[model samples]
Target: MTGHRARRLTAALFATSGYLATIPTANWLTTRYPAAPVAPGVLAPAGVYVVGLTLVMRDVSRELAGRTPVAVAMAGGVALSYWTANETVATASAAAYVLSESLDFAAYEWLRNHGFTIALAISNAVGLIADSILFLSLAFGSLHYLPGQVIGKAWMTGAAVVLLLLRRRAHHSGQLRAPGFSGATPKAVGRPMRRDGGGHDGFGDRAGTPTHPQQNETASEAMP
Candidate 1:
């Protein structure tokens, strides 16, 4: 694989790991602090805003791993959360995550052709809404944490925007390839290279008369 492709695969796996990790992390945080301060005036379970983190992570995974790992991550996150979290919380988490991630993937695909930032921003927004509402409502059967949930997750999304800007800077600096969800890299156009003799341009043909054409003719003549 090329350097660019390798970078992407590593990034995708990293995001996937984060996605899976949020399951246990959120579980632990919620158990530790049923009401944590996401904002000065807003209190929510520490786990509430992680939905936002997952939203952005899903976009990165989609960009690199495409639909397959997204699906796998969702399923694996749910199954793993069951083992790592309270049964009730696990069910709520799984249900909300699957629903939100599905929408996130669809939104990403819809907006992808426009641009990476546009797609990621929109998808993260939508996913955060779905996950926050569904997870909170199902887990707690109340909207008391809605404000904190929104604010915390929004902060995370804002962070995603910054991360995206950095990614853009890296790409423009030739540290990475253009980010895309198209699942294909742009083919690089290259000048034909010369072999032992050198190139026809500056390196290949060093003689007054070109020898490649003559050699081909000579080989054909000798063969016949």
Candidate 2:
């Protein structure tokens, strides 16, 4: 297979693996301990799952050279997370994870396709709004005795915004250009050279006369 195809296959496998791993990790965390701060068992695994999935999606996007599929994959992740959990909190958390992740993917793609500085700013802002609403609502919305959802949402949103900003600043800027050629501009194959020593111009001429001086000189000289 060609190199691009190979890379795309590899990326798809990696993304699938990461996505599968995230489901159990998120479930395990929220279920094992039904309390605040959850536990290291839950939080650590969930955190790792989120980060890993994010990385995988990013890599896949890079490999595919597009953002739409990546966005769709992220949306799938959220749906999967929602389905995996049995409890309300767990379900909420899973749902939150999905929303937050999908938003992140969208933002990331937008920034990638657009200018880094502006894209980063716009995506981060939008991501913060989405993450805050989804995460806080899921994490604290069901808890009766807890403070207002807005309070939690605000804090989470602020933290997420900071993190996104830092991440954007730290990472190298620019979107990944897509691989493979389209029908409109397929990659050129072997080019033909003129017998007359003219440079190749990409067109092959099977019937063109020899243009070389030696061939022509002999023909003309011999002709009297």
Clash pairs, candidate 1, are 198-203, 198-204, 199-203, 199-204
lDDT of each residue in 20-80, candidate 2, tens digit only = 5554455554455333332232222233224333433343343344445555555565556
What's the CA RMSD for each of the models? 14.1, 16.3
Candidate 1, lDDT over the whole model: 0.66
Model 2 TM-score? 0.42
lDDT of 1 by residue, 1-224 (tens): 97745765787798787877776677667656778888888898787667667777777676667778878887877787777777777888888877877787788778765556777888878777667788788878898988888888888888877877776555333412323211223222122222321221121112234334435333223321
Q: In model 2, which runs have C-alpha deviations exceeding 4 angstroms? A: 34-84, 114-129, 142-224
lDDT of all predictions, in order shown? 0.66, 0.42
